[model samples]
Target: MTCQRGWQLAVLMFFPLFLAACAQTPGKGGEVPSAPPPPTVDNAQSSGDEAACRLDDIQYAVGMPLGDPSSDALARQGGAEQVRVLRPGEAATMDHRPGRLNIHLDDNDVIEELRCG
Candidate 1:
């Protein structure tokens, strides 16, 4: 019984250290590098207002060729702050950035849905 209790105490003491070691940042000295700057699109347009990203403007794009859309195409079709094309099984964060458009595509590489986030 005493040996079992000592083993349990030892495990409790080392568990957090094990977790910390597992979570260490990769690269030199375990120091995490700063994140790179957000991507910049040359022709990305700014709608200025959250409501400015109207779904009706780009509704026609639903049946268009499926692929990553160019900033120019998005600007011409829908004047939004940002446009993201999501493919099937691809995970996207739930954060809703104003004036941002999310285009969801099916496995067949066809635009299936569009909405402003």
Candidate 2:
């Protein structure tokens, strides 16, 4: 009948529309939510204008913000090694041998001052 044809056409049209909508990510309550701000760290604690110092097997800097270890064996032995500027995905080693004024993430995990000779 005429009514059946109209219903079928409506269903066909609405199905495609519904699929298209489902493909997209819906916002909170059908509304786009505001993005949260990035977490920040205190820069004061980091090595401020400190020179990168490499000593013996240990390496570190004068002002590199260091993650205070919770009383570990290394601390008990004598003192843990120092921290120095390093590549984003690399460790502070002789091989890496970061040069002066190397852009690196600070001890606090935020990009800050670089190391210098």
Candidate 3:
């Protein structure tokens, strides 16, 4: 009988320790640990100042000869945040970058369109 009582007391004392060992420790500062946010797509073409991009500021690039150094100079002088010249039928991603002036040219290398994207 004494042996059984001793075993019961031993188990009773160790049970609380077992439960303590199984419990999770609190996070730093005693705050509950939260799940990390889900992954999101990263848009490489997005400009930080999209609202400030004004297409009308770079309209002078239209009708200019493409591949001409003078056109790039003009775009730089026209307050364009960024300049991208694309040739006709050229493969390009549709991603728009704000604060940028995209100059589209035809097969003849003539500037066909100028816009901010």
lDDT agreement of model 1 with the native = 0.75
Give lDDT tens digits, candidate 2, residues 1-117: 999999999999899888987786769789866779999966563444433432222223324443432212212232333334454667554433222333355446543443333
Which one is best on lDDT?
Answer: 1
RMSD for each of the candidates: 12.6, 13.6, 12.0
Error of 2 at 6 (Å): 41
> Against the unseen true structure, what C-alpha lDDT does each candidate score?
0.75, 0.45, 0.72
The order by descending lDDT is 1, 3, 2
Per-candidate clash tally: 0, 7, 1
Residue 113 miss distance in model 2 (angstroms): 23
- Candidate 2: regions farther than 4 A off: 1-30, 47-50, 54-117
**lDDT over C-alpha atoms for residue 81 of model 3:** 64
Per-residue lDDT of model 1, residues 11-112, tens digit only: 999999999989848678876878899998653443444545678877877866664555447645786777888887898999766678887788777788
TM-score of each: 0.51, 0.22, 0.48
